[model samples]
Target: MNWYVVYTKPKWEKKVAEKLSEIGIVCYCPLITQIKQWSDRKKKVEVPLFNSYVFVQLSETDRNLVFQVAGVIRYLFWLGKAAIVRNEEIITIKKCLSDKSVSDISIVSYKKGDKIKLESGIFSSQNAVIQEVTNTHYILVLESLGCILKMKYKKDV
Candidate 1:
């Protein structure tokens, strides 16, 4: 069985995953704890790590099984074919979500030549070596990709 990505209705990731699981479909819906604030108080809530997305493991013949559940839009497609999620990538997500160190990441100060493993965003699960750091952004070298990435950072005022 191969893991595949599924697109879900907005705010329905968890629900879809649960429904799939109930029907004997193996699915993963990564979640993260976030602090949400209200005028009266603040609360910690678990939200889908990837909004409107869930990963399902099933045979190609059983791909349509997910449709039996509600809130599943469709299987994610890439290059005109269903997108396949590598097993290693799914393992990485599980590890990151359970790892505590990432929850305490503080990039307030940077050290040149420091290597970091990204846990989210486009570079998720990729390792990058910090080449240069500035108040606005960091220049990172992704040896695996054999390229340098320069992206902006937003800091609270």
Candidate 2:
């Protein structure tokens, strides 16, 4: 058996893992808990470490069985063969999941000249000139109109 990357349908990482597990295939969907605030309140939620992918351990002899799982896009591959992911990468991800210090990971201050992409919301598809970014918010000068707008984007943005 080897570790393989499974490309999942958009936002279907958990679902795919479930289906695979029910069929006795071992899978891993690493996640980190995040505290998010909406207009009215704050809540903690678990989110996938990788947005659209999950890892699985499967036998090279049973490669065809993997494709039968719902929501599995395909096994990540190169050069016309299944690609095996190194075990060390998975070990590191597992460490991060188990580490209490993960929540204490520092947020570096954003510099004026840094390039950024919008990760979500109305302007999710555009890039902006970052005027300033902080632990919880960012001030960007939207490129299209040259207007400055302040947004409270998630840390990963």
Candidate 3:
């Protein structure tokens, strides 16, 4: 069985995973602990690692079974087809979560003056030169469009 990504309603990731588990569907909802603050006090809470996403392992024919549970909107699609998550990728996510000491495994190492291609968005398939790198975002110069773009990404990566 291959792993597929399921899109859940906002803030319903954990609930959808739980319901899927109750029905014998193997689902994974990675969570992390965070300190949340309100006007009065701050408390620790477990939040879904990836917002609105849950991973499930099942056959292609059984993919429809996930829709039987509430809060499941649909499968995430890539290139007009349901996206498939590789087995090794799942294991790696679990491993990194378990081992905090592991260094950041960013797929692309961005330094100043490196030319890279924007894979998605209107700038997609266009090459951009790295202008600056910051703690949480990158400043790229897309000369073809005569505009500079700033992209923000997760701090963990």
Tell me which residue pairs clash in candidate 2. none
Instruction: Tell me which residue pairs clash in candidate 1.
Output: none
**After superposing candidate 2, which stretches have Cα over 4 Å from the reference?**
104-157
Q: Model 1: runs farther than 4 Å from truth?
A: 104-157
- Report the lDDT tens digits of candidate 1 across residue range 1-157: 9999999999999989889989999999999888889999999988888878999999999998899999999888878999999999999889988998788322245579998997788999999999998977989999999999996788641
Span of 10 residues, lowest total lDDT, candidate 3: 100-109
lDDT of each: 0.88, 0.80, 0.90
lDDT of 2 by residue, 12-120 (tens): 9988888988988889988777788999999997778777778899888876676788898888875687778778888877987798865743225667877778777
Model 2 RMSD, rounded to 1 decimal: 10.0
User: Residue 13 in candidate 1 has what lDDT?
Assistant: 94
RMSD of each: 10.8, 10.0, 8.8
What is the Cα-based lDDT of residue 107 in candidate 1? Answer: 23
lDDT tens digits, residues 1-157, model 3?
A: 9999999999999999999999999999988777889999999888888889999999999999999999999999978999999999999888877787863333346899999999988779999999999978999999989999999967552
Worst 10 residues of 2 by lDDT: 101-110
Off by over 4 Å in 3: 102-157
Question: For each candidate, what TM-score against the reference?
Answer: 0.67, 0.63, 0.67
The candidate maximizing lDDT is: 3
